[model samples]
Target: MEKKKNLLLDIDEVFCFPGFLDAINEFLESNYVLDDFSDYYIDEAVIPQERFNEFNKFLDSRNLYENAQILPYAKEVLKELDFIYNIYPCSSCINPFNIIGSGRLFADKYNFLISTIPFIEPEHFIFTNAKYLFKADIQIDDRLSNLNENIETCILFPSYHNKTISNDELIKRGILRAGYDWRTGWLEVANILLDQSQIKDDKIKRYLKK
Candidate 1:
């Protein structure tokens, strides 16, 4: 076997959809959805500055991270990718814009994976803003800011908030987007990143790697 490929997978938007945004919409009782993520920082994009206190309260009261719905194709895709890639649940627990007064944001995310994808070892979980620190063949994330020039292939997970980013800009940054059709996009990711030599073995791969 060749060297084990490193794949950095983001949790918040990539696998765990709507995360804090879902909680905020429910707490404010607003119809705002993920598409409303026009601004990079969710604070400026979604909630008003005045509502920060209530936002903190909402996060404190509910285990949003633990309860947030998993994105479609996430479970099956990750399991499939595991055969060809060392999956790392790379995510940032603390919101940079929000003060994060309530510690639930950090702890809940950790437990969220424990409950959701228990197959991914806890040691592979990373929660930090320093995404560039992780060495990987490819990094999948929704936010472009988390990526850098180092990672070989930075696959931008398309979302409502990031629809406006132009293709030229993404190419300039050496980022690849699989369009908004995430289910197909994920399969494409597995195909593109999976080692080509494993053609015969890929077919025989089981859902749960033994």
Candidate 2:
């Protein structure tokens, strides 16, 4: 049997559509004064520990875990790609303290993904600050900043954060490719990898066809 190619996938916006900032804004709109809170990505220290507790509790109450929706083409594409590559689900939760405030919290969240996403074993899930440690052949992630030039990386344009930056800018800067939103972007990734793999297969088939 041939060894499968390694493919790393990001969660959150990639598979599940939580609207990360949107959800937080909704929580703030209900309880806090939004007067001067223009920047959603505020430093973790800026938020009083009490307010952070409330936010975390709200997230857990909503059962954000169960509410996660698989991206439009994710399920189908994973089914096809599994035939050729080992699909590993990798994700990073900003500020480890946001969940349960320690390494244990990270472990619990990783376990949640393993239970939720079928075909994804707990061993394949990784929750870390440094994504490059995994050493995969390719990685598909939505955050452009996370792109590592050394690897074959695919930068996925996030739906909520469509800033002025273009995918071309990311590639020129060093990313392999930048795709549009998750739904269609994932399919394009699967096709591109498959096509590359097909080229090798085609060469072998040429002599047989003759």
Candidate 3:
């Protein structure tokens, strides 16, 4: 029998929307700083140390861990996928502190918030600078540039940050074949993966019943 393929899912933006910059702008405004950091989108291609530090400060100061909101349908999608495939939560950290300390802190906070959800596990998590190190069959992420063509499948979850890259451009670059921006799309992803998983289990039955 062939081994089961693993599905790697990104946490931030993909599952939880960390309102880090937004929260910073709110805090700044309350403190009388008129500057709006709301328009700031972390540029994935560029790694500016100063800008990174500023971003980290924003996360640290505001206690952003509790503020992170799980995207709509994210829980349902994860539950559905878990029934069929080996699901792994994979996320990349921007700041050095995030990779070392902040990452674990954020994970702990996230797990606490979503503790009501029984299927989500902390041990199945991975924090890394290079996501490619994990040999996954599929990776679902919001950034198009991070997609590795050598991987089996890369699903792009559209976001405001990636406005410059058109869907056609993504396909042309061989980054992704299909993209989605809402929970409905996430459900479709679950259905696709579940249909592929050969496991005959109660979870699969429950999802099918729905």
Please name the candidate that would achieve the greatest lDDT relative to the true structure: 1
lDDT of 3 by residue, 43-141 (tens): 322335556666556556544556667766677667766765677777765555554446555555455445734675667777665886777888887
RMSD of each: 4.2, 7.3, 6.0
lDDT tens string, model 1, 1-210?
Answer: 887688899987778764667676777787776665566566566678898777776666677665676776577667767777788989877754445553667788888888888888899998887887888888898888877669898998877668888999999988988676554555555555554444334442332223
Candidate 3 stretches greater than 4 Å from native: 30-58, 94-117, 177-180, 191-210
| TM-score of decoy 3 | 0.69
lDDT of 2 by residue, 1-210 (tens): 888878788876677654434446577663432222334344242456678877766655444444556677666556666667787888776554454544434554665576666676667877777887777777777666665666665555344444445656875866644354445665566555655434333432232212
- Candidate numbers sorted by lDDT from highest down: 1, 3, 2
Among residues 3 or more apart in sequence or in different chains, the pairs in candidate 2 whose N, CA or C atoms overlap within 3 Å are none
lDDT of each: 0.73, 0.59, 0.60
TM-score of each: 0.82, 0.68, 0.69
Pairs with backbone N, CA or C atoms under 3 Å apart (clashes), candidate 3? none
Candidate 2 segments exceeding 4 Å error: 19-53, 60-62, 94-108, 196-210
Give the Å error, residue 4, model 2. 1.7
